[model samples]
Target: MQVRNRQRLTLPGCSSSGGSSGGSSGGSSSSDNTLAAVGMTKNQFRCVFNPSTNRDVLGRANTAAMIDKHWTQFTSAASQLNFRFGNLDEAAVFFGMVRHEYGGYLDDMRENCARQGVACRQYDTCRQGGNNYYGRGPLQISHCYNYEAMSQYVGVNLRSNPNALLDANNNLGWRASIAFWTRPEFNCQGTWEAVRAFPTCPAAARAGNIAAVSQRINGKVECNQNPRPANQDNRVSWIQNVRTSCFGLPRLTSNLYC
Candidate 1:
């Protein structure tokens, strides 16, 4: 199975500015200290600054720590990925994907990989020796070619050091997610193009064309498996949860499920 970077959202204020409200979320230690000191929830302080994760998934405690540890890397990656959206509709759908993919935690990411049999192997014959490109980072990028591509894009030489994706401080993993989002693949256009297209493209997302978006990232409906575990269904459910929790959109009425 080919593992691609799927459904990574750029958090509000994490990406570059597209509108007045959506400024860069990268702040200094003092800001983080202040947020933590004030006893604010992750939703209030806005955790995972770039491509905000679901507050329920990350919670206040983990969100605060992630902000303090990986905010800089997340911001850098968000800028490159163009996480900032022109409207709330675009944000809802895009971030929905992010929440579905990462849930703002490493353990959740690992579990997803395990379910799909991705990045769990010891070695791969498809590429050079010792290239264990098991799922790492927010997007769970796999395969050696992907590692090489990400290495070139992020200037990290991931092909040589495949384990670099596991580093939270350096955040090679999140960067790989962003890199994957911007590039085109799976026969559908890139998310960058869709987000940048403004009203028209965002309208599609807002209208609940999630099936189309899934194809853009996943190549096909991997979520709708038959007779057993439903990957696509789970993804759709996460997107719905994210829309409700992160964006405060209508929980039941919104056309979130694909």
Candidate 2:
């Protein structure tokens, strides 16, 4: 799943300049101005990831145009599915997951697939020749079954052509990620429905429950550890950073770890 050293295609409006510093740390009155119908704005995104400071997996500096394009595709895909964030907190949580999942890289892939286990024989033919159905896209969708299921949801043959998720010409990556996010089915440990339930949960249940959300995403590896692992802590930190630093909201004081 790791990308070999290759010349990356120069995307429109992106420059080869180094990244900028991280965003300023402070609350903003406009933090709650986000609308589920429109998703995150370019300005808000910049607040989370300053292009000059944040670099993609490929070492390219994020740009305003790049952020805008991603937002457009993200909202378009969400609209197609008629999915909307329940509130700004939900949207912030989603971005927090995204930041931890792919580091805001559209073409990002898992660094390795050696430990991903063997592919399912039933869908063996679905692997695109030499390609492995390792993690790809925003949520790092992995495995042959997942690719097959996502293919059905997206109406695209992702199982047969897993590279489609990395297709920069279209929004397939975002679509797949959004589809996975909203799916009610189980992945590894819990159902994505649990993550989606965050917005409607009681105040106490919702308080710093990013660990509950992580349980659905990667619970087997990161959750239930007496002493939380660094990766799990990092995931929760992203949510906290986005909630407080980027969105100017109070930090969740409880259940911060899985």
Candidate 3:
């Protein structure tokens, strides 16, 4: 499943910095990189600057290539959303969701729509010369209620034409994700909040189950207040689970939980 990297506990020149670490992993390419696997269900491997050659570790071989092709879009969208959120926990959660939503392919969603007969029908009398049926955009913001909101927000007349899902330039790729970040329909219906900074999240910083702690943090802020999935994705790893990830403490300068 996940092809992991060779483990070496000793980090390079890692001094007792307050929160940052100095360890490095060796990899010729990004695809060949190793991820911190089998622990935090959330992909928690430290990012390496080299090109990736490690495919299995990231659940796909061409991940680096794909990200490279699309990272600009991702980063740009993330930049806007982060400004709104003002929190790193939120940022990481968005990262995970983006990876999950379209396999990072803003265009791949077209395939999903094609499968659902979105491009194949005719209509008369309903509105917009009939409508398509595929799920729309990165957030799967299906149905009229959701789409209408997005259309209004975007100032587009999607109510009439309805073929806007495939456009890569518009905000649907990223904006829609943020719009639905914690809607009741998603896996946790919880907007992924950034992990509290060290000291702010000491228990979580030291613990193994990072996901649970992150959950606790968002839960405190009502980001995760909706109904959860039946068999949920494990929120975090053992170390991440050990600490409380709540962002409500004082000195917390985060953008979320406001």
| TM-score winner | 2
Candidate 1 lDDT by residue in tens digits, 115-207 = 355565553634556656666666566667677767776678877887677776675666677566555541223335533332233445656
Task: Give the candidate number with the greatest lDDT.
Answer: 2
Local error of candidate 1 at residue 135 (angstroms): 1.4
Q: Looking at candidate 1, what is the lDDT of residue 208?
A: 62
Give all candidates' CA lDDT scores.
0.50, 0.57, 0.33
As for TM-score, the candidate ahead, 1 or 2, is: 2
Clashes of 2: 3
| Clash pairs for candidate 2 | 19-52, 20-52, 20-53
Model 3 earns a TM-score of 0.42
Candidate 2's error at 66, in angstroms? 1.0
How many clashes (backbone N, Cα, C below 3 Å) per candidate? 10, 3, 37
| TM per prediction | 0.61, 0.72, 0.42
In model 1, the Cα lDDT at residue 215 comes to 51
